[model samples]
Target: HFGIVRFPQKKNIVFQELNYQYSFSDWIQWSMKIDSDQKTKEEYDKKIILFPEKKQIRQVDEPWFDMLLHKATIIGGEGRLGRNNVIFTLSLAYYSSGYALETCEYNMIEFNERLHEPLSSAELSKIVRSAYSGNYEAASREFIVELCQEWVAPELKNKDLFIQRKGWWKFKKPREQRKYSHKKEWKEDLVAYLSEKSYISKPYLTLSKKDLASELGMPKRTLDKVLKELKEEHKVFYKVTRGRNGGMVIASVKALFGTIIQVRKEMQQAYVAAITEKFGLTGSFVLNTFKQLAAPYKQPEEVRLFTVDTG
Candidate 1:
């Protein structure tokens, strides 16, 4: 008879359950661990099979299984996995008792599933602007890291520690060169960059700080600071319109426009690809694009952060 199996390790008093699909004998039977403790079991299992290679267990791909392993390694490891069963069980029970799922049809639930929501148009714009700012302290990395670290770290000590210990992403852009291109003019460059991305109706010939900086091998951080200084001096204007609060300063309009447009286009494309197959557009590309852009409306607070412009 087929039934769900709940395994309880001695020291790890918590119970780990899995739905087993039985086939003929043990040869074809398959089961997936639902808890994060699977990694612990796997390590132990791997060690057990060292003496007898023929007795090794079959490995299968499952999100839950991976999650379990991730948890075991991250959360617990008082020496070997099963060394302190009681502590493991207590920890598992304490953690699993609080488990809550938004949906039951679970297609491999992620740890941050509860926290993650789509970014709205305004929010996307803000993230882009912040990225342009190049100030790590003021960037959204703090909030993003906090949101993501909760599910993964058992005891995160500090933000810097998390950043250093955990994985972090970096932005890359090419160096700027000035001699070959048209002479740098703030107004002209800003207009050209925006027009290229269809942000503005017409392209002007002036060079923006961002664009010129790119052309002249200026560091992104240095460019952002210079743009801010220029904004204060009335040499550049930071413009913010409806919905998405993007910026175009007189000094760096060209580079800023390029960055914002590229980010929006990439985000839109990713959203489209993710949902297109599930909710078929009937091959209607226009309809699909509209649908993808319509998302990121779930959280207004989050959306507002992205929409706030320097202007």
Candidate 2:
């Protein structure tokens, strides 16, 4: 139903004529600042969701949301799908709660001849509801409607008229009958994936670029970008294998003189502690020595990780 957008200013201009329940600015601002309303803030806290980008909690008189709202483009006069229907610039678009302002087929042309004759999103929703159960496709859907009735959550809007089984339950039944006791979950966590290598385990070490992307369910283009970042961070390396067109990804392991050491964030503290105890090093002396050993690999601000050199 929605896609992330780049270049908010450009997107605002592109969707200037569409109807939306919440503006893009509001969505982005909420992530940056909490609500000013006391009751609203209390309810938001109850949800247990944390916004990492949040810089400050809003004071009652703050204008944080308005600051973002004013940056967006808006259409004026008439010719809109319905009344009070604003558009999103860099966020998902949705209609207002129980908004019944229907643009007539005849009136749509009058509004925008550029659009040509077509059914509006509202009309399309009605058509889609016909295929699904009435319990699910209820009109004027308002789950989480109280949380800015205009900004009701998508998942909360779901409804079932009768009892039903979750899709996974059926899958589990067959596995249980077979006495299956093991399952491996596929999570798309990049950090967790990179940090969990065993002594002899280098899963992606031999995977070709294409196969790696398929396993990660990532696009080849995106995979290339991620690999580049990982390589720069000394986390992984992309080395071309002999007799192959596509290269493979290898964990950044430093081998010197008959000894090997893997440089990873997970190993950093342990490496530091060991050196501190063995050589009686402490404080800046430890950091300075680590830096000397890990030179040519500059500490990229607080992001850089270090390991004891095998020398």
Candidate 3:
């Protein structure tokens, strides 16, 4: 036999159950030893009348209870998801907070320690909430917006921000995740410097690696790397000369011609043809006309004649 009971508490009521089981032999013995007398039968009947029938209660599984347990595990911060794991990271934060679609604010101090740049508290919270609610498209959009602001903003460029640290942007990947190539920028600056000096007919500049690195505000190793790339591309020529003034001489091959010489041979031919056609003259006539036109423009050299007479 089983019975269900509800215990009342100050705040809520708790439901409990009690159960008793009897074997076949015990039931048979009890049945056979039943009272036959009228008084005993009346008492048995009264007892039976006093007790209520037991109702069979089926145990139902509550999925929500299991979900709550899972959520608690995540909220306890048992593990960390990598920055590259965007969806998983957001989901973890979401489930941990009791499946909250949004959080009030992001932990700025934590972010600053990790990413070196603290994102806006409100923006990060909204993005996390959006990702948690399975709005991946919206979450992605918000994430990209923040990433651009942090990574590509003009004011942020050249700043010694910590882009190498992992898990910098929470759900977004770090800048170091992809290899950065500054060869183009370096080459441009180097070329510009060469061009400036070459303008004064100085096609080459000699400087030590350290000095060049200092001028470019980069490490010597980085300068070497950029120079190597520039050399391979044939965009700039450099060589180390040996002497008291031994140093790396960077030459601008393209800048040697300070002005671009545009040959107009075809234009000259066209002009000759037009003059011949318009004047209805032969090639010889055009040639003679050009000679006569140029004669007036020619400056004659002064002639000094000395006469030595024999007496």
Candidate 4:
């Protein structure tokens, strides 16, 4: 005969044979056997015990599971699932949801302590829905860092009601230092700083690397190393004049565009001269032909090519 065991508090149901000797602990083991891989099962077994003295559920190695159980206790009540049954219910929920371990760990940290005592069913459902739907693997590092900050160091003091016992706050202090080591982000910040300075001052003005390092709050050695790499990549240049203040200058986008326009103008003039010589046409005739060809794209103002008079 088949009998159904319903855990109303956990919203879980299990089917068992009435004729066989089946304890709730046996059901948990059986469920874990089917659902978890050997590695995960072994790890879970090492951390958690089915039944303990005074029925206190002890989670040893798995912080994620410990947090989950704590949140579950807050939501479902102390006696809803026994020490033996809670893991089984949560395990079933976890396996059925098909989230990776990394995803679960990160998302759990993000939504940590969001659910609390005197919980409403609607609020619980929303929290559960977010946990299930979250894609931590797809999330960017910046986004994860920001979320961690919000969890650990919220702006308003009143919002710090549910600070997690685990060291989430430990993350906030070292994040800026960690970002300095990241080459891509560091380069982008440097470029933005240079661009802002170039805009405020005249374009293509020489900037002191020492002053720039001081302004950016970075070491001169680090700035020099990054500048050397950027110079090799043609992203920046330095003017090696014999003076105390002479140093590197960031290339301006406006100056580059002006150079491009000047080159194009010179190329157009050469092409016109070549056509005049080939056709044995007069300079005026070739010039008129070029103007007719460009008539469709006539500019409102005359185009003046940029030039520096050395004389």
Error of model 4, residue 135, in angstroms: 33
Model 4: per-residue lDDT, tens digit, 27-83?
A: 888877766787787898899744333432222222334333454333332212222
Residues 1-311, candidate 3: write the lDDT tens digits. Answer: 22364566755735434465677788767665663466687888788633344443211122222222122112111111212223223334434444434331233224322543333454345434544444232222223233223333424321222223222233534535745535566678877777777633344677887888887666678788888886666455577766787787675534532211111434444544543454344656544443332221121122211110000
Off by over 4 Å in 3: 1-181, 259-311
Task: Give lDDT per model, in order.
Answer: 0.34, 0.36, 0.43, 0.43
Give lDDT tens digits, candidate 1, residues 122-214.
Answer: 433333333223232221223223322443443543442322322343433332443432223443453344445433222123344455567
How many steric clashes does model 3 contain?
Answer: 0
Error of 4 at 17 (Å): 61
- Each candidate structure's TM-score, on Cα atoms with residue i matched to residue i, is 0.17, 0.23, 0.26, 0.28
How does candidate 1 fare on TM-score?
0.17
Give the Cα error of residue 230 in candidate 1, in Å: 32
RMSD in Å for model 4: 26.8
By summed lDDT, the worst window of 10 consecutive residues in model 2 runs over 86-95
TM-score preference between candidates 2 and 4, better one: 4
| lDDT by residue (tens digit), candidate 2, 1-311 | 13575666864665564565687787777755643566687987899854345242221112222221232222222222111121121011111112122322222223322322333555333322221222222212121222222222223322321123333332455533654322121222343454444232232245576776686565677666666665455444346565646455444322110012444456546655643454343646645534443432121124333332111
| Superposed model 4: Cα runs more than 4 Å off | 1-181, 199-201, 242-245, 252-255, 258-311
TM-score of predicted structure 4:
0.28
